[model samples]
Structure formats: C-alpha cells, structure tokens
Target chain A: MATERTRVMGLFDTEGQTASAIRGLRNDGYTLERVHGPIPSHVVADALALPKSRVGWFTLAGGITGFFCGFLLAAFTATRWHLIVGGKPIVALVPFVIVGFEFTILFAVFGNVLGLISQARLPRFGPVTPYDPRLTGHKFGVLASCETARKNDLFRFLEAKGAEIKADEGGQP
Target chain B: MTETALTYQTVDDTVLATLRPPEKSYWIAVALLFAGILMGAGCWLYQILTGIGVGGQNNPVHWGTYLINFVFWVGIAHSGTLISAILHLFRAGWRNPIARAAETMTVFAVCTAGLYPFVHLGRVWMVYYMLPIPSQRTLWPNFTSPLMFDVVAISTYLTVSSLFWYTGMLPDLAIIRDRAKGTRRKIFAILSLGWTGEFEQWRHYTRGYLFFAALATPLVISVHSVVSWDFALGVVPGWHTTIFAPYFVAGAIHSGLAMVITLMIPLRKIFHYEQIITIGVLEMVAKTIVFTGLIVGFAYGTEVFIAWYSHNIVEMETFRWRAFGDYALEYWIMVVCNTVIPLLFLFKGVRTHLKWLFVISIFVNIGMWYERFVIIIGSVAHDFIPHTWGLYRPSLVEFGIMIGSFCLFFFLFVLFVKHLPSVSMTEIKEALPTGGGHGN
Candidate 1:
C-alpha cells in the first residue's frame, strides 16, 4: 500500500529557497508544515518552528532504570545464591558498578532505538508517505495539505514561487 | 532548501551506484573470503569433534592463539565506535564517509571476537552455563570475576554498537528504498522502517543519534578496559597491573584506527569513492593513529618500568624475559611494528601517502596481535614455577580458525559494501553546505 496525497509538494534546491517558499505559503494563509532537507537544517526548522524532540528524556529515564536494575540484579542474585568466593562481601558495591555501567549503556541504547521508532511513527506499512526522494539528498522539500477546491491555487502558488511542483496523489491511508 | 544542480537524487545515484552487483574483482574477493571461512569452519568442526586438545592450548599456556585473536579482533572493533560515536559527538566533518564502514567493521569484529570464548571452551555446548539465569542446579556465574565483566561488557558493547549502526543506516536505506524496485525495494522499505525523511522523522533521528553517541562514548572506554581486566585481575607476572585499563583502551583505539585505514584504503579504491573518502580523511585517521601509537608506546615503557621498579623478583624477571626470552623475536617485532613504525606518521608525507599509511597500518595490526600474544602467552609460558612453565605453538586447527575469522569478517564487510551504501549518503550530503563540492 502507498500513502494518499491530500496535499501539494514542491522540491527546492536549497534550504533558503525552501524557507522562502514556506514563508510565501504562510502569507497566502496556507498552513506550512513538514519541511524536508537532506540534512537537519536549523534554517528549515526555524522557518517551520518545529518542536525540539523529546528523545533525550527517554534515554535519561532508561539509563536511570538500567543503573538500578543492573546494581540490584548483581547485588540480589549474589545474596540469593549465597555462593561465597574468597570470603568477600555478598554485596560488592565496587564490582557491581561495572555491571551497572554496562546495563546503563545497554538500556539507554534500547531507549534511543525505541524513542526514534515511536516518535518517528515508523514502519507505516499501509502506504508510502507523500515524499520526494531528493529530499534526503540535495533538495529541500515542502508538503502542505490543501482542500480539493484550493489544490489548483496551491500548485500555482508553489510553481510561481519557483518550486518544481509534483502532484503527490496515491494510495488510501 | 536552496537550488543547485547537485540535488538529493544525484547524491543518491552516485552512492547507490557502488551498491550494484559485484564486478569480477569483487566476486574474486568474496570467493576468497568464503573459502577462508569454509576452511575455518572445517577446522572448528574438527576441533569440536576431537576435543579442545586439537588446539595449541596446554596446562601452562592455556590461553594461546584463540585468546590473542579474541583480543586482537575486539581491539579492531574499537575504531568503528570511536570513529562513529566519538567523532560524531565532536562533530568532526572528516568522519562522514568513514563512519558507516567503521561501525560495520565494529559489529563484525565483535561477532568474530565473541566466538573465541566458545571455541576456547572445553565444552562449547555448555556455553549457556556462563549466562546468569535460574538453573536446576542453581549455578550462577561469578560477577566478581573480570572475565564475567568481560562477557557482560562485550555483549552490551555489541548491542549498543549494532543499534547505533542500524539507526544511522535508516536514512541511507530510505534512499535505497526509493531507488530500488520490486523485491529489493520491499526489503529496503521494511529495513528502513518507513522512513520518509519527513521533518518529524529527521527530528527524532537526529535526537536519537545524539543519544546513541552519548551512550556509546563511555562504552568505547569501558569495553576494552573490561577485556584488559581479564589479564589485569590475574596475578600472572606480566599481566598484573593497574595501568592495564587505560593502556588497553588506548591500544584498542590505536589498533582499531589502523584497521579502519586498512579497510577504507582498499574500499575507497574499489568503489571509486575516492572523492568521498578522500586523502584528507585518510590523513586525519593516520594522524589519530600516530597520537594513539604514542600513548601505547608510553604504556609499554611504563609497563617495563613498573616491572623493574616494583623490585619484585618475578615481575622484574618477567620484564627481562619479555625482551630477551624465548619469545624475544615476537616481542621485538611487536615493539618495532606497533611503536617504531607509527613514528613515521609524525611526518606529513607519511600521513598523506596512502600506500605508506597502509603499510604502517598492516604493521600496527600485526604488532597489536603480537602485543596480546606477548602479554598473554609470554607471561603464562614462564610463570614463577619454572618446572611447570611451557611454550605454546598454535596447531594447524587454531591457525585455520584464526584465518577463517578474518575471512568471515571480510566476507560480511564485502557483502555490506555491495548491498548498502558503503559511504553514508545522508551524512556526506549533510556535510556539504549549499552548492559545496559533492562528497567532500
């Protein structure tokens, strides 16, 4: 399945050009959203006023959880098993730190992966999203949802603003 | 979002071209790697059937070639994470082209390294006993042992490194997905997790990338340190030392950087990605090798000095034996290859010259292997008990398996380069400013 386009999209060569088009679209009362670039661009993000992603919070939470879990696992298991070696303390804090440190990294990585996939709303197998391949390369792209009545005007607006407009119509969501 | 003739499509076309089906040279290389893997697998099977005795390990020198290779490969794995995560954190632009290949190498090297413990075990099937789980007999692995820490650290490092690598590949995979067709397209689509390069997707990806880099940075230091503890925790004459952690970490990065150059020089040549992986990047990597070589050399000096300074008869004797003992040849070779050769990189000409850099890298690689061997077997072979001491020469089985591990690594790498963008398209594109030269 592929994504149905409910909007008009344009491919621009650079971030500045995309920013200008987005500004022009906003002036014309079109809601500006989803600016795409080959790289993460502060210019494009600023133009669209994107929210800062909260992925870091997930990582922090995962790390804290991992620390406690790792420490407790080592401390608890040793006491539970009661297999004393070399007559050392059952809860060896210094040695347990190693396990804790490792698990912190392990769970933080897991959190990062989960955060990326969930926040990105990934693996949408239903349909291909309305997109341009060049958006991930050198071109900066913009997609603006429009009503059927305003579609022609939107295309003309994009074309007049020097965008290489493409009709992104496809599968049902 | 500005206009240029070099658009996203062009970059995609250029990088994806390298992913095309193999030419004759590629085919030959893959075949050779496959043959090496087959020979190694056969040797492993022979060893498994005939017992661990088929290998070179004996009473005194129990940890021989397999353990050395394990350390060697794990050291080789370090550069990938260092290059990818460390440099990314530092925002070093030269790291763009090198990141993907380096991370891939890390994963494959770790996989190769992980196999040795199993191979070294008397009963490979009993490997599950190493895990910390509830058992009918209530047996639990000792967490206090550095060897146990090694198992946890390496496994955690592997998981984190793989995740970091896979996360970074999504954008590139999306590019491939868009360019491919039919089954290939479907495969990439699934692998890419429906990436559309949408604003939200990129936002999450960038944040997640930063988080992964942060998480991986400490791992680069910790994993090798734990591996070092495997020896440091032991009371063996040469192996017992507090400096082992930092020294091992430094050595890991040193050898890993050399391995990266060793792989990338040939890779860029084969893929004709010279423009992307230019001499500048290679020179930068070479410079890093020089820096790391100095640290390793200092550690070596410190090791010898500590041995003598400690005034312990066994420690002093071990230090003396290292340079003038039965394995004197290997010891000197390690010093010359690891420490002395890397000194040539002090000159700009050596760092810039790919051929010279390549030669130096091969030497560093050999030196590192011998360093581990010298540290491991050298100490074990001549313990405090002269009567029990013995030398270990690897049997053909061990040699074959060692060779096979290298082959397996190359095979995976070769397959990765052919199937995916060897040079990261998104990162290289990101590096270039508006209208900048392609893949610089």
Candidate 2:
C-alpha cells in the first residue's frame, strides 16, 4: 500500500550550504530526487556519491571498432583494384594506419557524445519537474518526494540545514 | 559590469546582451560582409563559366592562391582546438572566456576551408568523387592517398569540433532558454535539450567533454599533419621534408593564435567584456605566441640548414631561388611577418598592450598567408627542370575569391557573436562568489 507523497524543493545559496543539506538528507535516510546547480561541483558530486562514468567503455569499444573498420575498408578497397605506386604493395599496411587513426578518433568522438546523451537521459522535453531557473543561474537546488505525513519534517530538516524552502510551488501546498 | 563587481547575474546579462537586437553598426557590417560574399560568388561563378585557368594557376605554379587559401584557413582552424580542448585538459582557468569564441572560430574556419578543395576542383559537380561511396563504376576512393586522408581527417575535425562546441553550449543555451519568452524560448528549449542542470546531466556532460578534449587533441595534430602530407608525400624538392609535419603544426598554431587575438581584441571592446576576458587571459595567449613564433623562426633557419646540409642540389636550388628569386618580396614578407614581428611578443609590454598585440597579429596573419604562398607556389615555381620553372600571380578571379573567403569568415563570425552568448555564461557564473569575483 503506497501513500501519496508531497514533492518539496530546497534552494541553497552557497556550495557549502548545498553540501550540508545533501549530507543531512543522507544522514536521515531521505533520498534526494535531484540536485541542480549552475555548474558542476565536486562537493555536490561527493554528497551524491555518483560513480565515475563508464563512458570510456563506449569510447574504447568505438576505437576498437573504428580501427578494424578503417583497416578493413582500406584493405578490402585496395584489393578491388591492383593499384601500386613506386613499387609500393597494393595492400599497403603502413598507409592504412593513417585511416585507422582518423577513424578511431571520429568513432570515439561519436561514441562519447552518444554515451553522454544516452546516459544523461537528455533532450528531455517540457519543463523539468521541481525546476527552478535560478538553479541554472546562481542557486543550487535539491528536490525530494516524501510521504505526505513527513512533509513538515522534511521542510524543517532542510530549513535547519540553512536551505530556503520554496512555498506553493506549482500550487502544491 | 566592471571587473570589480562580477556576479552570477551580471555574467548572464553581459554575455546575453550580444543577443539583443542588432545596432546600426552591426547591420552596416552585415551589409558590407554580404557585399563581399556577393563579390566572391560572382567571381567564383565567372571562373566556373570560364574554366580552371581563370584561377590564374599557370603551369608549374599550378597550386596557386586557392591551395594557399585552403591551407591558410585550415591553419587558422587549429588554435581553436588547442585553446578549447588542450587548455581544458590542462585545467587552465584563463581559457574560460576565450574558449567559446575559439571553438566557434574552428567550426566556421573549417567550413570556410572545406569549400576551397571543391573550388579548386574546377569542375565542382564531380566533387562526389571525393566521397567514399561505392561508385557506379565500382571504383572507390584511394584509401592510400593523402588527399583521401585529408577528406577523412578534415571532415572528422569539423564534426568533432562542432560537437565539442555545441556540447559546451548546452548549459548556456539553457540559460538563454530560461531568460527568453514565447517563440524564442521554444527554439532554445529544443536546442538546450531541456537541460535543467541536474547532477546526472553534469556528470555525463563533464565526462564527455573530457573525452572530447582528449580525443580532439590528437585529431587536431593529425588533421594538419595530413594536410602537410599533401606536400611532404610528393618528391618535389622543397616539399619533401621530415620537418614539414612539426613545422606546419607550429606555423598553423602561430597563425591560429594570432587570429584569436585579431578577432578577440575588437570583440572584447564591443561586448564590454574587459572584466570577463581580462588582460591576463590575453597575455597568456600572447605568451604562447612567443613560444610558437620561436619554433616557426627556428624551422625557417633549420629548413635552410637542412637544404644545405643534405647537399641535395635540387633542394638547395629551391631554397636559394626562394630567397633571391623574383618572388623574394613574398619570401621576405613571410620571414618578417611569421618570424620577426611575432618576436615582439617576447616583451611583456608588447604582449599586454592590446594595440601592439592587434597590429602584430595582423602582420602574423599576412605573414602566415604568404608563408603558405611561398611554400606552395614558390617551391613549385622552380622545382626540378628550369625549363618548366614558372611564376604565378593570382588573376582577378583568384584575388576576388580570396577576398571573399575572408569576408565569408568575418560574416559567419559576426552572425555568431550576434546570435549566441559570445562567452560561456554558466562557466562565468561558476567563478562567482557571494560578492564580486575575478574572472578567468
């Protein structure tokens, strides 16, 4: 039996304050719905305990694929025509390395970008829930959904930690 | 906002103000650039109707101005990545304000450079032959060819640079989105991909940006090396050299940094971003010029030394002819501009003085263009057989096209400054404190 939960938001002024509130939430076993800020901050990252991104796996996979693809494309195409220059072999392995280098980078870039967008769940349309534009400007923000009965406790919990609680956000009481 | 009063709000207000409705001067600039574009298009069309000879690339000097413009523009595109990606990897804070403009310069410069090869083709319609697609005749492009390497390298450079630029812009676009109204807001909404600065977004975005920087560092170096191979692979006397790769890379960065200074000085004044772009940042860039300039000068001396040291008569003749021949004026201009004048950056007063940096940068720009001109046409003009030796002077068509390319670059640049926040608003805000903060 699940109870309806109230969505509450907290706005913080300083990086120190943001970290403090997030730490308080963790100590009390309250999960943060989201933390938003104007820029990336290590303090907030540490507070959330986010893992190092596995995006490199994507880049590694892409590089490996690109190297083989580039080498094969050169080898297969060169075989189609018995082209040789200055007694150089038709299947010139040395020359093919240049193609491999370029493709490895290109595919790696593609993979990195794809991994970013896919992992971030980006291109999210409409307004982000519990959104505050200032979070994109000066402020740091934290949002949490909790049991309706625990709403006041969460607000008091955030306020005690120096966070300013947003009132009547989108007509929520 | 003054440098003494920097805050998060002012960062947004100052940069986004460029997006305010255009001024009379702005339109005048746009009109002038448009006229230049039209002049170039007319010349290009005339050449198309007339034939490749109209480019005035006579025999022996067949590379001509188009190839010079090709390499020149490609060289200009390099420093942007060096600044945006390399500096980021090194965690240089001074790169903050300038990186946005540098990255944008790369995308457009590459765009401008990419057109030259097609323009050089004489028959631009057959340009698809450069693609790697399966031909109707079953002939694929040569993977072994340096030109094909160029096709791959440059297109990849363009793609990577653009993605890097756009990825960095995501949070800034969201800033614009938050501040806009109605239709403009909707457009930014889509462009921003609904970014709300969530930890998840930042996590992936930062990591991806890191990899983009790491990957782009090598790509930028390789792109120009492939361009150098366009000459180095050939057995032509002056064109064949092991040093061309590093020499060209240094020269490319030299011109690229100069262009950055050339464009940014005026941009800083216009946007009233003295606080954001600060003299310290400019000095940092100028100091880099001293290092790059020294390498360029050393390469010049080393080239002469290498020619004499090798005892290769053909190569020796090429060097001798370049220094004392009919095109000696162009040769000296390259030496002075690319080498001598940039040496001024060795002094702190010159490096910090905006006007000095700007003037010297213009000279470097000229010198770099002549540098390519000297290397490409000068070398070819007097290669193996004296009987085939010939000189090139760009015809009206070539001159018009070159002028148009400059105008095209400036035109795209003007549009970029006007439409987008010329500085990174989010990055600037990251530097803000509870009070006034110093900008990077």
Compose the digit string of candidate 2's lDDT tens values, residues B1-440: 45658777778888988899999989999999999989998999988898998888878888989999999999999999999999899988788889999999999999999989988999999998877678778888888889999998999999999999999999999888888888898888899988888898898888988999999999999999999999999999889998999999999999999999999999999988898999888999988988898999999999999999999999999999999998999999999998889888889899999999899999999999999999999888999998999988999999999889899999999999999878998777665553233222
- Model 2 regions lying over 4 Å from their true place: A167-173, B1-4, B431-440
Backbone clashes in model 1 = 12
Give the alpha carbon lDDT tens digit for every residue of B1-440 in model 1: 23233434556776888888878988998999999999999999999999999998998999999999999999999999999999999999999989999999999999999999999996899998888889897787778888888888999988898888888998888778777788998898889887777777888888899989988989889999999999999999999899999999999999999999999999888777766788889999988998999999999999999988889999998989999989999999889998899999999998999899899999999999999999999999998988988898999999999999999999999999898888788887777765453321
Best by DockQ: 2
- Report lDDT (Cα) of residue B110, candidate 1: 98
Cα deviation at B24, candidate 2, in Å, is 2.1
- Computed on alpha carbons, the lDDT of every model, listed in order, comes to 0.86, 0.88
DockQ score of the complex predicted as candidate 1:
0.53
Candidate 2 lDDT score at position B321: 91
Error of 2 at B5 (Å): 2.8
Model 2 CA lDDT for position A64:
82
Candidate 1 TM-score, true structure as reference: 0.95
i-RMS of candidate 1: 3.1
